[model samples]
Target: MKLLKLVPDHTNIDFVRLRGWAFGLTLLLSVLAVGVTFARGLNLGVDFVGGLMIEERFASPPDLTRVREVVDAQGLGEAQLQTFGDPRVLTIRLPTQDGADEGATNAAVKKVSAALTQAFPGATFTRYSTVSGKVSNELIRNGVLAVVLAILGIGLFAIFRFEWQFGVSTIVAIVHDLLMTLGFFALTQFDFDLNIVAAVLTIIGYSINDKIVIDDRIRENMRRYRKMDMREIINLSVNETLPRTVMTSVTILLALFALLFLGGHVLRGFTAAMILGIVVGTYSSIYVSSSLLISLGLRAEPGEKKPARVDLSNAERIAPRER
Candidate 1:
């Protein structure tokens, strides 16, 4: 049986020629992402915003309006109700008071549970969680710090591993990926929690991994084809690795899609973020990172300081030959 080929051999795509348009679109999207994130803000979950969350299941899909009214009437803080994986399931959230003790928190949970059960017969309280404002604040700080540090650290590594051009391009692409992910959450009103933070970090890791592969190829080509134009070298490098890139991305997307559909609603947000990240990461790696190298003054020649290697394969041995 003949194996299928995703990308043909000797493929020569002019990725650099379209850099102008790619850069323009990248800028537009990045700006919109940042703007949307600021304008709408993230819908933080109990993990980030310090709140009480109760997961309840009903024998049948209860009226959401009535459910909200009951929770609101309890005089708990503003109630945020959202359907979980199933229509018959719901997650209700209410902001917790600062410095609320364990007793007070449990009492609040009991109050909501009691009211919800009384108002809707056969309502089952599956679980509940509480986060103090102080703890949530710390989590937010740590999450932001972790993401920023990861990006910066990766950029520095790229710089050291290859060149300054590689590092800068990597950073730009990663920032774009993160902003796009955040923007998506802001627009969709998806719950932003530690899970999404993990997704973002994973996206960064995947993006850098893909970028490093392409960068290594580009650098190799630059050294081997010293006289080739930078544009040609970039095109050659990306095309050479196109098959690996496509295969990896396609395989990952397949698994992610499966998890997206089969995974419970609890994982839906994380899976969705991951799916978007893979697509965006691939695009940025091919179009943004590789193409930006040329604009960053990365050339096949000039400023190359490595010592030339001398081949002695055909040279006579200085040592005496065996008689």
Candidate 2:
């Protein structure tokens, strides 16, 4: 189960104070990023923009300039050319006009195919898909709904599992991770699409798990160390769990890096998003979530009644005599 065997033991840094500084900076940066995303908007892929997607196979790899010339000869709005699975497979993306008729669209496709055939004899092309604007709109709406639902689900789960403070802190961390990821996409202008949505959702789940793990430890420490200060207890919990957090992140990063480099163009965007998410998720779990807990005035001392037990089965247990 231990993927990393050389992780350093607990450090005695003042995590609560460090958490505050980190969260404040992250919040300010996030607000600015969100503003930019709202103003500039995401660079949505062909999936969200009704377009003609053609996959062509050539005896020899097609020339990019020639492909562009052929598609432009068809008078399509604009054509994007990229290699797909291999050098021989070319992907052509063409955006349909705002009010073009089906006849116009088909004619454009025919013109491009004819020109490409004339230029590169023996090359074969296939119509991968032609999505409509209406479908793309529906997809955009559904993707937003899914993200909202995921956040709500996480909040509800946190409430049931721990307390309102834990729920609030965890939700804030999730939102932070999401906004930062979106900011990265907007700033870099990545081909944000359905696959990116899947990546974001995966990040949400992964980030929340990290927060929950830390919160679980904090809750346990709160019960055990009744006399400790809130800051001390939070710090203790974070320090104790830091090794596991780091190891998990490293393992996820390695897998994502492999996908980024070796998985080809189809998985490039997906893996890039995942890589960014893992880094942001880990950072927010440690700094943003923990800091938010303190900001919400969560105290280590139990209020009125004892809190519910948080399972510590995986954590190292110290015997009474050892303690």
The TM-score of candidate 2 is: 0.80
Which sections of candidate 1 miss by over 4 Å? 97-99, 303-323
- When summed lDDT is taken over every stretch of 10 residues in candidate 1, the lowest stretch is 314-323
Across 87-107, the per-residue lDDT of candidate 2 in tens digits comes to: 887778888654557776677
- Clashing residue pairs in candidate 2 are none
User: What overall lDDT goes with each candidate model?
Assistant: 0.87, 0.79
Model 1, 162-224: lDDT tens per residue? Answer: 999999999999999999999999988888999999999999999999999999988887787
TM-score of each: 0.89, 0.80
